[model samples]
Target: MEGRSQWGTRAGFVLAAIGSAVGLGNIWRFPAVAYENGGGAFFIPYLFALLTAGIPILIMEFTMGHKYRGSAPLTYRRMTKKAEGIGWWAVAVAFVIATYYSVIIAWAISYSYFSINLSWGEDTEGFLFGDYLHLADVPGQMGSLVPGVFFPLIIVWIIVLGVLIRGVKRGIEIANRIMIPTLVIVFLIVVIRAVTLPGALTGLDAFFKPDFTQILSPHVWVAAYGQIFFSLSIAFAIMITYSSYLPKKSDITNNAFITGFSNSGFELLAGIGVFAILGFMATSQGVGIDEVVAGGVGLAFVVFPAIINEFPAFNEFFGLLFFLSLVLAGLTSLISIVETFVAGVAEKFNISRTKSVLFGGGLAAILSIIFATQGGLYFLDAADYFINQFGVAALGLVEVILIAWILRKLGLFKNHANEISDIKLGSWWTISLAVITPIVLGWMMIDLLRLNIMRGFDTETGNYEGYSNMFIMWGGWAVAIGALVIGIVFSLIKWRSNTSAKEETEDISNVNN
Candidate 1:
């Protein structure tokens, strides 16, 4: 057996962690979620949730990776052989995410070019759906691949696969060191420009003028927890894999805190920039801010372009900066997502990293093409919703329950983290994972199930976003459930005889069993 890969420096690891945390959701998703939930008041629960669920879980996962020194599946297996499937479950979710997430980044790449001339033209919504996406009239319609999306999709896979093949320190670390800083500088410039616009104060006011009453609602608190959970890239395989590359003596607790806060700080910046721009658009169109506000794809591609078109000057430059920010952010996160499975498969099969990248990443890249077709958005939307709901949220719930309650390993993790961390873990950390997080996440699953099951009665199509039930079944439910099935099945396959990871696990004490 040879030495495992490690980060060149703590800063490199921290930067990589931040890059994974601060993704497209920080830009497109967080602002709208905050606005919809409680305006400025949302931060109360948001910060609380961050402390209770987000950072605590981060510390736990960081400890798992650094202590076990393996990919998610390997880490869990090292924790307890029976628990290995949960790690693969996380990896499978990441694999599903990497497939469509790459396509969204491809859209950002094309939009970055389209920004040069405002090619989306006057009708931004129509341009996104009709011209650019060439969306089908009905759901689940797999029309021909859009040339605009396909070429960029190819480029996205190349860059991501190329990065993964380079290994951790030289590849993933170097990419994050460059991309994360550039993303911040570019986004900061956008934020600065956005706040300086005519109606910028209005947007800022809207964002910060907290309706304290919303804090009283459990739903708002739940939204806060969900945002913190999804935004920080916890409970997925990302944090664990990234931390697995940490050198011995790394500060696990402090690193988790840094990653958690840095991610939230950037989300704050994004919310300001986004709402300011939305305010500008609303003022220009003589409509209320609510009319112009949106999130996700619509906000990134449609509304932003429409707003850019309304800019008094420097439309193309700002558009380029905005979309370019998306590309950088998306790439950093995508790189981490892809690397999760790459590491898992490489270790599981005892293959070279290059071979793993080609085999695993190539497959994800190939499947990503589904989102490049005319029905891509429909499928993308459904898959994203179901995967996030069933895959991520449910997986997070299972992970906490398994680690905290079922296995009762929180104390062991706490001692391990405290030994290596500058900031020692306390009961709060244990209580959060053991009591607070599971309850919140468990409640989240129940609420989601209730809403989804009940939604069928409210719509003619009998499912999410009025997509046909069949489409939801195959495109939505199947993709989400399939990840878990993949996890269990993959765990059943024994590691190859020559696998070094199997030998490495012998050093750790079998406290889990």
Candidate 2:
């Protein structure tokens, strides 16, 4: 095999990790969840989850990646030898995620292009194609495909492919360098614009002013934990894949903290930026704060565009910056998704990097195209919930189980003790992974099931609304559970095979010697 390219520097790796962590989840989803759960009170649970759940899981992923020195599939196979089946599970989960994630990136690019053109204000109608095809109503048009959506989605995939074709150092690094900085600068500008908006303080107050009473609610706690997990890209194979390229001596614990904190801090800042601007808009337009804080596609497409239009002079410019930032954030994370598969292919087949990338990139593009035609936006949302939410949570459960129990049997942690920080994980990590975290995640799944049953039949439309909360919740978990089962079964089979092979190989070598 050719020499695998590692991250050129530690900072590069961190930037890439941060890029993955701080995407739509942070800027788009976090604020919405925070507002819906309990505004200022949501921060408490979010912070706690970050420290307890997010950081530990992140450290575990990073450590696994670095230790195995391979992609998710190969890494798990290598580490657990007998547990190669689990590696496949990670691969399957990652693949499902990458397929749909690209579509979202495509949407972000489409939005950014129009935002720069100021199309939202000049001809909002043109942004909508067929009667049901409105660029602004992504969640609403779940089951419908607009040519406008398909065309741009293809463009996004092609762009991602082009970057991957260039390889990690030249492609991934360059993209991160440009996208990460641009995202930060644009985010700052948006935040400043939002805070300065007349009467924007109302939104800021809503975000910052704590309603401590809400903290007592289990719903709030769940939201915080979900946000922390989702925001940091923990429980997914992305972090592990990204960390695979790290140098041996890098501090996994400190780096995990950096990634977690950087992500959460950005999320908090994003909440401030979004709510502040929304507050000003609400004050000016006599709209309720709830309207301004409406989530998912509503916040990104309809509400944000509407708010941008209010600033006639700078609408196009700021809109451009905002959407461009979204595109960059999405791209940064998208690369990692692509990399996970590419690395897997390379390791699995012992193929050349070039071949691996082409295979993975081609496959992803084809899958995305199919998705594009089939109500891409709707598929993207459903796939995201499935992969990012339940898929990741399940993976987290497996990882903790493997490390805390399975790896312990092999004494992997004993060797890793010196590499780990002085802050020992102890039984707490095991308890959380084996018991606490899984239970919490299970509860969220149940809650989601309930939410779905309630909303599945939309009385208003007399049809199943593509964007029904139930659909997102239930459909997401169904996909997640399916992926989890595949992963666990595959891991067990592969683990047995790998262990047998290793033992045979060792015995033969010993006999010959």
Candidate 3:
């Protein structure tokens, strides 16, 4: 195998980790999830989930990657050959995610350009659906592709591919260092401007107002865990793959804490910015905050473009700043997602870096073009909903079960982290992984399954209006579960060679015996 690259500096690794965690989800999803769950009271469960589940799993993955000195698949293979399938499962999850995730970045790029002239104008919703997408009635329909979406999406793939081809130190690390700081500065400017606008106070109050009784609902707790779980980018192969590039002497625990906290802090700031704008929207229309504020694609594509139209001054420039922030956040995270698979392919097949990046990333880019089509939004919605719920959450549950109970490697892993890390892993870490995380994650999985099963995912409006049951099931649920099946197949394939990784496995064996 060729020599592996390490991050140029410790700060580079931390910033890269932060970049991975702080993606489009933190900015668009977290604020709405918090407000809808329990408002002010949601913080209690969210903080609890962060400490118990988020940071603990982060430290575990970092330990595995740093100790085994390999990507996700190689790390799991070295830890115990039987667990190799687990690592490939993670790689598969990342691959599936990258396919749909890339199109989102394309949308941001298009929106950034649209910001220049306020092209979305008064009918932002109509423009997004009718003019921008020309969306189809359902999945599997071959509607004409929109060049507006396709052209910008192609640019996104080109930029990300160029970066991945540059190798880790020169490309991924440097990209994060530049983009993450700029994201912070530009987003802060957006937030400051938003909060001072007329009627901004109304949005903030609605966002932060406590619905104490809502805290009693089981769903609120599940929302907290889900937010932290998905926000940190855990169990998606990115963290482990990124940490594999760290030097042997780096601090593990402190880095996890930093990454986790930075992600949460950014989510809070995003909440502030989003609500302030929502407040202004409501004030301008003489309506309640609830009537104006939203999240997810509506919040980004439709609502925000509308908000910019309402701006008192420099509407185009403020719109440009907002969309640019989205592009930066999405790109930083997208690079890490693509790199996870690049690392896996290179490590598994013993291929060169450039070859791995081309093959793995090329495949994802080809599939991503599907989402740039007129009918693409339907597919993206179905897949995104199921992938995050079943694919990501299930992986988290199984990971803890394997490490803490099946193999009982948590003790040794904890010791490995404490030995190398500045902060010691105490009994609390053990209990979190063994007990708290698994139970919480397990409950989340079961509850989500139950809800989907009972009503079939929002039958009120059919979740997606025109999509058929077969299309939703196969396109969404099947693709998600198929990832696990494909991963197992990859694990069964012959490894080309892994000399240093195997030596580390022997060292772990010596310590165990």
Candidate 4:
């Protein structure tokens, strides 16, 4: 068998890590979350979450991967055979995310072209639902595929899988090296243009105006932690897989800080750019900022198009740059998401990388095609909501509990990371994982469960997004829970590789054993 691949340089690994962290959510999600939570005052909880939950978890996962020198599943299997299923659960979440996530990038690709001529026109919302997506009247419709989305989706998979087949250092690293810098440059141009718009100051004021009263709210704190959690892409089987490629002497603690800070910095920039333009839109429409505020698909596909149409000058060029940024950001993230399962499949079955890319990437690509249909958006929305809440959040809670309490391995991981890191581990790191994160995440889960239950009872709206309860049960809840069932089944299968049960346990250092 071939030896594990290592990153060519520390810079390459950092770029890739940052690339995974910064994605579509940074552009659309963070700005709205910040505004809705506490405006400028949200930073208090946001910064706290980053330090306590985000960076601490990143350091732990980085240490685990670097020390074990294997993919997420393999790394957990090395820790203990009983925990291999948890690793596969993370991989399954990544797999589901990759499916709908690629379709979104395809939307950006189409929109980039649409930007060239201001093609979406005045009725941006109508154009998106009626013309572009051809959204079905109800959920689970699965009408014929939209060529606009399907074709570009094919291109997205081809590019992502092509990169994976090239191996880690040559493919993932090199792609991030180009995409991350280019994404920054393009986004900077967009931000500069956005801030110069006529009502830019109004938007900036609305964004930065501190609402200190909201700081005491539990919902505000939860929003901060949720944004940090989803934004940094932890517990998605990504950082673990990416960090597994690090060389022996790499600084896990510093790398976590760098990745965490870089991602938050971009989110700050995104807040500025998004709000600045939204301010311009409000001014043009002679309305308040609150009237135009939005996030997710509506912000990207609907509000942004309306804003681009109102641009005083260079509408086409500015629109193109904005959507192109989405494309670049989405591609970089999609590459990382796809690679998680790709690496998992390759190592689990002991198949060649090429075979793994074909088998895994091909399946995800095929599954993603459903999102290209009329009911695609409904399916996408439900799956994304349920998966993030149930899959990623639940998996994260389980991961921390298993490693911290069940396996009692935080001390081992802390010692391993400290030996090679410039910044040594402290009680804060241990306390955050064992205590702080679990408590907050538990609150988040319970809150989400309560909300969903209330929604289920609502007569007018049966479930999330007003979809039928049956649809949410199958499309949303099933997909979220199905990942765990699939993970356990995968774990139960015997390895086809030369790895023996004893070898899995013995391969780790004495510290781990």
Q: Which has the greatest lDDT?
A: 4
Model 1 regions more than 4 Å off: 497-513
The collision pairs in model 1 are 41-210
lDDT of 1: 0.91
Cand. 2 TM to true fold: 0.85
Model 3, global lDDT: 0.88
Per-residue C-alpha lDDT of model 1 across residues 1-513, encoded as one tens digit per residue: 235799999999999999999999999999999999889999999999999999999998998899888889998887777778888999999999999999999999999999999999999999999999999988889999999999999999999999988989889999999999999999999999999998988888888888999999999999999999999998889999999989889999999889999999999999999999998988887888888889999899988998999888999999999999999999999999999999999888888899999999999999999999999999999999989999999989998998887777888889988888879888889899999999999899889988977987899977898888799999999999999999999999998725434444532244464
Off by over 4 Å in 2: 121-145, 406-435, 450-513
Task: List the candidate 3 regions with Cα displacement exceeding 4 Å.
Answer: 457-466, 499-501, 504-513
lDDT of each: 0.91, 0.71, 0.88, 0.92
lDDT (Cα, tens digit) per residue for candidate 3, span 321-362:
999999999999999999988988987788888899899999
Q: Candidate 4, clashing residue pairs?
A: none
TM-score of each candidate structure, all chains considered together: 0.97, 0.85, 0.96, 0.98
Poorest lDDT segment (10 consecutive residues) of candidate 1: 500-509
The alpha-carbon deviation from the true structure for residue 111 of candidate 2, after best TM-score superposition, in angstroms, is 2.4
